[model samples]
Target: MVFEYAPAPESRSAVDIAPSYGLFVDGEFTEAAGGRTFTTVSPSTEEVLSEVALGGAEDVDRAVRAAGRAFEKWSALPGRERAKYLFRIARILQERSRELAVLETLDNGKPIRETRDVDLPQVAAHFFYYAGWADKLEHAGFGPDPRPLGVAGQVIPWNFPLLMLAWKVAPALAAGNTVVLKPAETTPLSALFFADVCRRAGLPRGVVNIVTGAGETGAELVAHPGVAKVAFTGSTGVGRSIARSVAGTDKKLTLELGGKGANIVFDDAPVDQAVEGIVNGIFFNQGHVCCAGSRLLVQESVHDEVLDALRRRMELLRVGDPLDKNTDIGAVNSAEQLERIRSLADAGEAEGAQRWAPACELPERGYWFAPTLFTGVTQAHRIAREEVFGPVLSVLTFRTPDEAVAKANNTPYGLSAGVWTEKGSRILWMADRLRAGVVWANTFNKFDPTSPFGGYKESGFGREGGRHGLEAYLDV
Candidate 1:
């Protein structure tokens, strides 16, 4: 079915963005100190969305100092008081959830359905869950007495802009720490709106500072000596560099990075349910998800049958305008990301993998790529080994549970994996052997504030959601 732009299922409306973006510093939005600004374009139309301030090291220093100053008083406030602040923020997020969802879709190029139903709900839920934790730290198993880390520097990715901000900030504030956050340069609108939420929540001035720019600004924030802790979620390559950048510093760091997750289907698995899971495993969010199941390991006996079914299912996925209520997949986040995906697809064909894409017309202006698949991919193939952060998936076969385990654990990333089987014993056995941080037995890509989420190995360190999330902000 063609994706139609009907009313949002949740009845969310689009938000109007300011012509120019400003720095949210010390509780107010201000122009860049040097008046240097850059444009943010919509990936759906390839048109400039707004001009955002380009913050430099000097701006970073100012934000850090403001955060440090706020930390002195914020940390001294009782946990119950901090909990009230979080609850207020949560209420504001719900009140303006529709506006935030639309801005998220406009800026990030994800389906309005997902932004409304998935991301926005989780964004509010994260704050709600963390709010209850603010005063319960002593009972949280950290120690007899847990203290807040002074100031936290948080860097979030372009995939889930507002959701990631909520994940990083809610826990830090609940732990009684002030924050300096940097949203991805491509998708800064929702985060900017979030900064407004903080202001409306009556959070103390300088408690949260949002600086928008590219990698240079991020490096400045991560390297700032005044920050007591750092939390980052991005590419594995960049995560390694961040690890090195913070080395020898006294800052506490939590890194959440890339993944090449495996989705294993056993011969005894439910065929229709497994196929639906397979579609959602890799295609959801245009395959930009760090926990996306990019590698498909099927039981050899049913390999050909499953591949045919998967291909037929892929044909039905609607790819187009993210604002459409029916779109299953949308444009990549940016032009640069589209180019990277195209380059990797080219290399996959050159490396002898059979590539397949549904017969679909890509939009003329925006950076869009069809939902693609590569078959006969070997363990040695680059596409099978690397994290292709696009709507492209690789297919491989396994003869036994042991072989499935081996192939699943082959990559440097251990973020997440899916096991589809009817047998209870096999599910547990497979879950144990897979080295990923998250193992989805019958479900894939489910997020809850009550559940712990993170990755193992090069997928990065630190958990994001759940009670354990407080650990990142607390000095035990």
Candidate 2:
């Protein structure tokens, strides 16, 4: 007889969702100039969470102007004073982390475990890490007197919304730049909530402004002449567009774009640990991560062994409501995102690759896709080449170390890559060979505020996190 586990759902009462949210400019929430709005839903239940103002070009202009007006006063403040505000924000984040986590799970459809443990902790940690840096900028090796880049425009993606906001905002603020930020339309609630945190912290008016809308709002903000710097975390296609928009302009731009990261497994790897890494690398965040290890490059000698272990592990993953603590995989962020995943998975099958998914019943009400894998995948296959941005993995085999390195680096993206082996020398060699910005040896999906994270080539440029992250917002 099978033993069934009791349901353990996190209470949504932790957060008080506002019926309607507005553009946060000049430190206050106000309706959009266009008088348009969009409804944000909880992907887990298809429940409408709230209506958010849809920002337009005029709203973006107002935000940029607000940021510009605040830049001088904010930048002139002593680093010690700036540090104090950051510390307050960090403390507030910790105090209300539970509320934010539940709200994030509701808006983004990531598992509660991740929103609580991974996303919230990182968001707070990022603020704390950068807080310390604010007072010590002169001591930082970027010469004795690096300067702030006036007003910065930032755009963050839907995946890990709060964390991405922390990543972009923390370092930018620490560097003494005022900001006009645009959170992805689908996941704007957390950012709106964060604006409240700024108010509670007594941060000065217009130091940070959040404009909620789709791509057009983001474009307007980035292209605004008042913005001295632009930082974006999104798709490569959009990154390229931002690049073009900022070309020949005075704005300093940085992009953290898409990736088809590789997780290379060798025969010498510890099977159990490697299997865990493989799962975490791809399946984490429902595989919505930009640096997610979407491609698996396994040694041909141990292919069958690794596949069997992976299949067994995949079977154990529970897929359900984001609020359920036991859920390993949650609902996709939206109907559009679910459709994208479906189309890509279909392409994987059409290209003659063998597709597999564990026997798991999905909830009929909301957007869902099972954890999937495509074997017998070649480089030419669309699934292997494109960013699926879902809980999907493409398996490819390599005969030798040289072959593994070649296959891993063949893609246009070089955001991140992982190597799993017990041998120290081989790990070092593989790390040295991979063109990715971040390399993981015998580990996957591990992140820290001190570590620099970004990509190379078509994955787009610029790093976030650590001391390196400060450079993008500062004027040397």
**Best-performing candidate as measured by TM-score:** 2
CA RMSD of all predictions: 1.8, 0.8
lDDT by residue (tens digit), candidate 2, 179-251: 8989998999999999999999999999999999988889888888888999999999999999999999888
Candidate 1 whole-model C-alpha lDDT, 0 to 1: 0.91
Which whole-number lDDT from 0 to 100 does residue 248 have in model 1?
96
Error of 1 at 184 (Å): 0.5
- The ten-residue window of minimal lDDT in model 1 covers 4-13
Best of the candidates, lDDT = 2
What shift in Å separates residue 396 of candidate 1 from its native position after superposition?
0.3
List TM-scores for all candidates, in order.
0.97, 0.99
